[model samples]
Each structure stands twice: as structure tokens, then as C-alpha cells.
Target: RSNKRLVPNIVEPKIRTIEETVPMADRTMEEILQEPTKGYGEAIVILEILAENFEIKTNLLQLVQTNKFHGFERDNPHTHISNFKRMATTLKYRDVPNDAIKLMLFLYSIEGAARIWYEKKPPNSILTWDDLVNKFVNQFFPPSKTTHLKNEISRFTQRFEDTSGEAWEHFKEMLRACPHHGFSELNQIDTFYNGLNEQDQDSLNAAAGGNLLSKTTREALKIIEKNHKFVIQEANRMFLG
Candidate 1:
């Protein structure tokens, strides 16, 4: 039974790599604004890369909200809001199929609206960047919205399955696998609980009276300030480097 045959070990074949070109870094914001269509596409590509590299969605959203494209002046808040809204709409309606278009439309609409809401000073409602993110996450992935989009995409994909059918099916599967559905509920609950805890802590501090800080607490505050400075420096390095 021993040494009767030699067996060959076969290595698995590598699948073809999909090479997605990351947008250029050297292009100034001005260059991007000059022709918004290409520039906006590049901007989105860059944003996606930044999100992946940094693993920080909040920071990425802040960067996008603050970015001033070429032909767009910085700190012109109105222009920035307008440009973002236009870009969002454009991306929503780009030559993609109807199902994809609808999904993009919903995403961009909520995110774009939230960005505008966040940029307002003395906002009618006190909504922070975190608030915006929380709201979008909730609305998009809620059972009602998610189920509707799923059914719409299912029907749309089925209708076109005969023409480039494989691509349509693959796209639908990708949509089904998106993580937004799961994260939406958790993020909303976390935000709610965190806010409640903060309010309770503040109330307790107020009830304690006495300058809201004893000598020990004052020393703790100093330590926190020092730590915050270091944290800021680290964040800057991570973001800009």
C-alpha cells in the first residue's frame, strides 16, 4: 500500500485583479471645480480611498464637506453647499441602471442634506456631524427603506436579466450584501444612549454645584487638556500624512 503512486499538488489559479485607478493627488481643488463632472467623480474616488485608508467615516465626511474644489473659493459656505448638492444629484443620476441610480439617489440625498444641515451656524436645530451620520444611517437601513429598495432592485434586475443579465445579478447581490442595513440600527441606538448618558452626567455635575469641579476634578481637567493636545496632534498626523 505504500509508495504505489505519486500525487501532484495543484496550486489554485489567481483570479484576474480588478485594477481601479485611484484619482490623482496633485490636482488642486480649483482644477476639480473647473469641470465638475470629471472633477466630482475624481473627488468621490479620492474620498472613497481616504475612507478606506483612514478607517474613519466621520473624518472622511468632514473632509468632503470642507473641501474646496478648483474654481471654488474656500470658506464660501453657500457655494460649498451648492456644489455638494449638485454633485450629489449628478452622481445619483449618472448613467447607471435604474436600480443602482435609485440607491445612489437615496444615499446622496440624505448625506448631502445632512452636510448642509451640519454646516449651518446657529442651526435652527442643533444637529452635529455625528447627528447627520446617525440620521442617514437610520433612514437608509430602516426596515421600510431597505425592503423597498431590495424589492425594487430585484424586480429591475429580473426585467433586464436577459441583457447583460449576469452583470445585473452580480450588482443585485452586491447591493444585498451591503453592511449599511446592519449598522443602521446599531448606530442609531448607540447615538441615543450616548446622548442620554451625556445629559445625565451634565445634570449630575450641575446638581453637585461648587464650580462644577472640586480641586481633584480641576487637576483631572488639566490632565485631560494635556491629553487632548496630544490626541489632536496624533489625529492631524494620521489625517494629513
Candidate 2:
């Protein structure tokens, strides 16, 4: 399910120095907007140099190539067209600064490129652009019904809308001591869902209106529900006993 693109290793090309690579602030507004493709190329070159110097493992070349203002077709013709569409759509949603959105765009771009690269394979066999988008959307926004309980908890916390200093201090302490902990833990459920065996969790995920629950959380929820019901039934039996 990885969407990372493969980039070839090559010696770093000597071009502009890092300091000189920065975009100039003196340019006119129009010139600033159209500041030649050279600036973009130089920025990418500097990035490659820095990545190499730090031994950072990444597909910097693919990013540079894809981000460039040029038309370079892949071995498969359809891949070129699809990549263009994916890149355009990505720019459309670039306003949101959330990490989820960033990761989704990056993954979608890579997946789109991959789809083009693997277009010659069997009809049913490769990952497509639609698949990438579906996976990302499902990961970030689970079904309404499935997320109801978590939403309830969030609403409950927000009910005490006290902006006062003492209220803030008490709230912070309550947060620190709460068993469920911070708002971040709720987001981690998606990450946790990704770690489970796909077959075991996919069904429950579908039932919940897409695979929103992480495998661990899903399993824990099931166990708690079962145990609670069993305890209640056992208590009734004890009364009869």
C-alpha cells in the first residue's frame, strides 16, 4: 500500500549555492509570480544536494520531475495524462494545511504516477487513482455512525467552555489525569487501524461504514461490549442462584 515513488541515485550536480538559491524579495509582483522556472529548478537542485549531504532516503528526483513545468511522458502514455489530472486536483485542495491533507496529496500523486507506470498490466491487477483517493478519504473521515461515540466525547469536553484562567488550569489538569487523554489519541485510531491484518478488520470496518476503527480499537471495543453484556447476564443468574 506504499505510495512512494522510486528515484535513481546520481551524483549531485553543482549549481547554485544554498544562500543564492533563495527566491529574491526585490522582484516586482508580476515577476515574483512568474519568477522563471530556473528559480524552481534551482530550489529543487539545492534540495537534492541537502538530501544527499544528510543521507536522507527519499525520492527527491521524482518530486522535482513531477513538480517541474514540463511535459514528460512515462513509458505508458495513459500514466502521463492521469498524473496531470492528479497534480491539478492536488493544487485545487492545497489550501488546507493539515498534515492529513498533505500526506493524502503526496500519496495520491505517487499513486497516480504508479498507475501510469503500471498501466500495461492486467486490467484487475494494479492500484488506480480512485483506489488511492478512497483509501485516504476512508482513513481520515470514517463513517458518521462509527464515529458517534468519539464525537460524543468531544462534544462533552467542549460543553464546559470556560476561557477563564482558573478554569483553564483545572481543565488542563483534568485532561492530564483523564484515562482517554488528549484529542490526539482520537486521531491515532486511524493509524492504529492501519496496523491490523486487513482481512480480520476489513469486515468490521465495512460494518462501521468504512474502515475507520484501528484494529486494536475495534478489537478492544468488541471485547468490552461482550464482557459488559456477559457481566450483566451473570449478575441476573446469580440472583436466581
Name the lDDT of candidate 1. Answer: 0.33
lDDT, candidate 1, at 138: 53
Q: Pick the candidate with the highest lDDT.
A: 2
RMSD of each: 27.1, 20.5
Q: How would you encode candidate 1's per-residue C-alpha lDDT over 25-85 as one tens digit per residue? A: 6567787556333321311111111111211134333444455333211122333334455
Q: Per-residue error at 234 for model 1, in Å?
A: 52
* Predicted structure 2: clash tally: 2
lDDT of 1 at 21: 20
For candidate 1, the 10 contiguous residues with the lowest summed lDDT are 7-16
Q: Which stretches of candidate 2 lie over 4 Å from their true place?
A: 1-127, 139-150, 159-241
lDDT of 2 by residue, 1-241 (tens): 3333222122332333434434466556677556343332221111112223322123533453464322132232233334445544433222222222222233223344343332223222213345534443343233542355345434333123432222224333433333233356444334333333454245446544554453456564564344335545776789999
- Model 2, 124: alpha-carbon shift in Å? 5.6
Candidate 1, superposed: residue stretches over 4 Å from native:
1-112, 119-132, 139-143, 153-157, 160-165, 168-170, 173-241
